[model samples]
Target: MVAVFSEDHVSLRASMKGLFAQHSSESEVRRLMATDEGYDPVLWRQLAAGQELQGLVVPEEFGGSGYTWVELGVVLEEMGRALFCGPYFSTVVLAATCLVESADESAQKEYLPRVASGEAIGSVAFVEASGRWDEAGVTMEAKKVAAGYELTGQKFYVLDGHVADFFVVAARTSGEISLFIVDRESAGVSAHLEETLDQTRKLATVTFHDAPARLLGAENSGWSILGRVLKLAGIALAAEQVGGAQASLDMAVDYAKTRIQFGQPIGAFQAIKHMLADVMLEVESARSAMQVGLAAASGHEGLDLDEISPLVQAYCSDVFELASHQNIQVHGGMGFTWEMAPHLYFKRAKSMALFLGNSDSHREQVAKALGV
Candidate 1:
């Protein structure tokens, strides 16, 4: 693949880093985490309006920046480093990706503009109690009605569901899975907040009892659309994981250099130096893997997403989790306390490891992609 980073991309990354540094400080992250909304609307507005980040991957005709996946991946990486709390991943990565991949032009025309403008928050409701991220896991049912369709069932662990204006739901219709757009304010819709391990990211259990719905894409095509959406999600998340891992390694190295166990710094100790070196190697490897994954995702190298997606997801997920654990070990007892920021990343790494799919599942996918 060609070099993914250009002068403009470097400038954009710097701008995103500056934005997060200015707004998502540790104190700010803590303050927002305590709030019910789990994010700052003013800061979100600045990102969407001032910086136009919400539209980074959206086309210009749809009222967006018309940028490529590289830009989107970089922005997500910065967000992971800062642990910026919001509906960005839900709306921008999942929902917007579905819209972009869909063949339904009318839906794109209607919904993409709203998402681009930050006037609406969108989330995809797919996983159920089974906690499976595939088509076979969807048990929600949708029935045909006079006006439109009616859905009955529940979706668990929907990201940003409590605050979302609409949901792109996956439901079984006539023994086949289909995608539907349901308004959050509909009469039969109920959204209850879910207490997740990662409080930095909001999640909810959304139930539908004869909820009004509109079809998205084609009939029995939800699974296909979901495949593309999940691939993009994996790529974006790999970028984020690399960022988090790098930050965790940085934290450990900095602490080792300053904290003294004996006469000299702990970093001067051979054991501490070896541990930090191992973490650095893993983080850098994950970063390289993510860059290649992004290039494949952007179709820049003519590489298939099927082959690269699972590899990056599995490797990055493991790397981030390992880095977080090592960071805590390096900090000793201080890292386990709630007052420390390392715990935040530790929680996030554990939670996100299961988001799209766990490392084992992705590894399975990787093997299958390789004809194993």
Candidate 2:
């Protein structure tokens, strides 16, 4: 087989960006944001055929592109820059990761191939009504039945929940967390797709009443897998933030260079220069943090990597949020308008940070991991 990355990754990133620029325009974005689907299937298919996004993590033996988290990070960063809305995160980062972490080889064989080929869109249904992100937040129960495990209760804030072909649900079974894969249109499974604050991303509330679900791994051993999924999701989210942060910075720089004040370009003003300088610092520092965290995640499996995960998540969230806010301020009142896409990215930054655990949550995790 060919090497995973050499010039390939760079070419992949560039091609994906070219695709984004080709397909993503402000009007298309506004139309996309207003839809309940929250994504464009045509665009998604284009991505799968063009860049092979859905196969980033799936093994080559299973019909995947077989790239590491770093390559995944590169493509995702470009997507973020374009504010591309789709199931890439829901299926690849969340659901695919959940399945990959499962101990069930049969399940992987059945699901990972579909996910890799973009034949199935899988999503994680872990959060509840109150929208808690912790594993302990799961109150849904599962019971073993002759047919299959029966599930009861609901999941809220499911990213891409309404449209996913299948779902990886976290449920309490025998008083312990377990993973289950349920077809979305299966009996007794219902989802209320709702309008969300971030139009670029979709959310839903899924209710289950004796829904038939196939087991993912060893029952009662799910929290461990969920924990690993969260760590990797954090890295993916950080890479996403790096894209948003740098994009925001670029937008601000371009505006500063062209937007004129009384006599000259507003960028010549001390205030704007300092603001740009500060943004540069935040972006670079966050980039470093993300790199370190990515290293920690993909490093030697048994190596004692310590608190790198939470640190990266916390720093990345803050830096992206900062960059988004500054980008708006730099653009003046025009930035606040819907005609401008600043708010799209800014909203995305906020949602991504909060979804896979946030700055504060990751910090607390870091403390717990540190035993402080």
Candidate 3:
């Protein structure tokens, strides 16, 4: 039975590999990044309708596939390998997970189906100019109004915010942090795209000028939900970083084997071989850490994610950033050139290391978990 399950896992990964190879080629990724929207809408629809990828983690009753975190990890790793540029992470991993974990059934019923169907692009706005990801980081205020609520403040580092149809915003209400849902096209809401270091991903600054919003969960109780959201997002991103590390290692090894230097293949040299070996070790080790963290987050009995999640985030970010740097070293000058793909992965590694929270912050979480 274990063998059978392993086979199933392999099959799922194969399917993802094929899907990305056909639709998310390197050229296609480059082309999509240059566009105004920074993603292929047709291919996005194909992924949603044909592959049913958008609803992979949503519960079956809520119009999703009812898949587990393990499956989402698989898809995320493949997406990272191909550098699939889209709103999948913001929509599924962040916003959808928040709704599923929140205590608001009405909000779940209203938004889950649209997100499952890929009819709406959703993002979570939590970061401010300070760029912190914890509950105390939120400074935006949601004021009580006759219409319902009014939000006034600005949020930066909103993933895919310029294109998201709606946002799950973290705001302060009566000295307590809360969550609210606001439409992107509302009268006083404005989303401006930011120029990010990684062109493959998008970020925005969203300003709420008395923008009308609806409370999501019980007022002053959204911090716990946001906590879960951050944990899940970290797990998902760790999986992606593992995949990216593998890709960088593969790129370095492949180039070393083919690129002749000093009248022989550079891979034959001891330095190149050692560098590749170290990167391979980092990639495999990080993959194991990510898999263990994914399992813990997926509700493995007797395992506590509070202990594993931060470790996974910190370690994976470090290894991926290091692997990307080593890949550039292996490629030499060509790695730094814009035309080469190593630069893209390098920037992605650096950017993702800081996403949601930086490695140092997560390391602090680990320290707190250990009571050190």
Candidate 4:
């Protein structure tokens, strides 16, 4: 079941919608995507200082507003709706959440304040060449050194890695999985941008050759910590997917209503009507799943996040892809052109489905959780 929204939630949504409409329009998105940074630094600072969105979930003592996951979900949904090209997911959802979920309060205190104030950008590096999101995929070695620890391995498809100030990396120590915090400027560390299907969100191949690192949480407990973080990430991503799906549906419907064929609007046709109706149904269903997932993440009673997170991820992934594809179909030839917006959403949908584990993998998780 979807959670009911309060008046504050409504106000927040409206404020975010207005902000994105002005700052993250299609032209601005195109401009930012083509840049080396893939986002606007000025706007990022505004999000932190003016809106305090970067610290939405960070606690009060950490220079944050101490907001809950539900509030962050609201911001992410608006970002997805606008196709805002930024490191928000990498920083807030991945890196910040990793710090918050870790057992090390020192790490949180050291990092969360910078993250909240937007003084630094952070990302998580876990997946290797195998592109696996599970603990078994973490093959990077972290060896104890006189100074601290040294990490030696490569992490592929790290979000915003090229520009991240720091990273929360997963590595193996004495054959046990562990997490580490590695500075971007650490000796023997390098990040190379990789060509991706979605240029709006950048990915990089990060190499660590005996790079200095700080241990996060307890040894051999990285998987458990990461499990909790990934569940929240899945829920957050599902909310974003729901927003994107709704935007795609809206675009398709608008195009169908205006484009003329046979002396009538294309939307008047039975086939088009049915197609849009189906898209609407899928989008709404995805939204409901996302809301339920968010509720589960918020510790709502009787909601098991282990089951709901994967379910929401799988369902939202499929829905967003379908909606984006149908949007292109609705636009006909114009959608195929670079000047149009449908292709961008389509690419984002496809790329996001693969991130943090694809729909098929999530489905398997759901099956395992349900024992079905």
- The TM-scores, one per candidate, come to 0.98, 0.94, 0.97, 0.99
lDDT of 4 by residue, 1-372 (tens): 666478999999999999999999999999999987899999999999999999999888889898888998899999999998999999999999999889589999999999999998999999998889988888888889999899988999999999999999998877888889999998999999999999899999999998999999998778888888999999999988888998999999999999999999999999999999999999988888888888888889899999999999999999999999999999998896999999999999999999999998999999999999
lDDT of 2 by residue, 80-117 (tens): 77777788899999999898888688999898988887
Clashing pairs in 1: none
C-alpha RMSD values across all candidates: 1.1, 2.8, 1.7, 0.8
What is candidate 3's lDDT per residue for 98-135, written digit by digit as tens? 89988689998899988888888899999998878887
**List of clashing residue pairs for candidate 4:** none
Judging by lDDT, tell me the better candidate of 1 and 2: 1
- In candidate 3, residue 296 scores what lDDT? 81
Please give the lDDT score at residue 230 for candidate 2.
80
- Please give the TM-score that candidate 2 achieves against the real structure: 0.94
Report the number of backbone clashes for model 3: 0
Whole-structure CA lDDT of model 4 = 0.92
Q: Write the per-residue lDDT of candidate 1 for residues 1-372, one digit (tens) a residue.
A: 347988998998898889898888889889988877888877777778888988889888899988888899899999999988899999999998888888688998998989888888899999999999877899888899999899998999899999999999999877888899998999899999888888899999999999999999888888889888898899999999988898899899999989988688989999888998998988988988898889988887577899899889999999999999999999999998999999999999999999999989998988888899
Off by over 4 Å in 1: none
Candidate 3 Cα errors over 4 Å, as ranges = 1-5
Computed on alpha carbons, the lDDT of every model, listed in order, comes to 0.90, 0.83, 0.89, 0.92
Top candidate (TM-score): 4
- How close to the true structure is residue 152 of candidate 4, measured as C-alpha lDDT? 86
Model 2 ranges off by over 4 Å: 1-8, 300-306
Rank the models by TM-score, top first.
4, 1, 3, 2
Clashes of 2: 0
> Pairing residues by index, what is the TM-score of model 1?
0.98
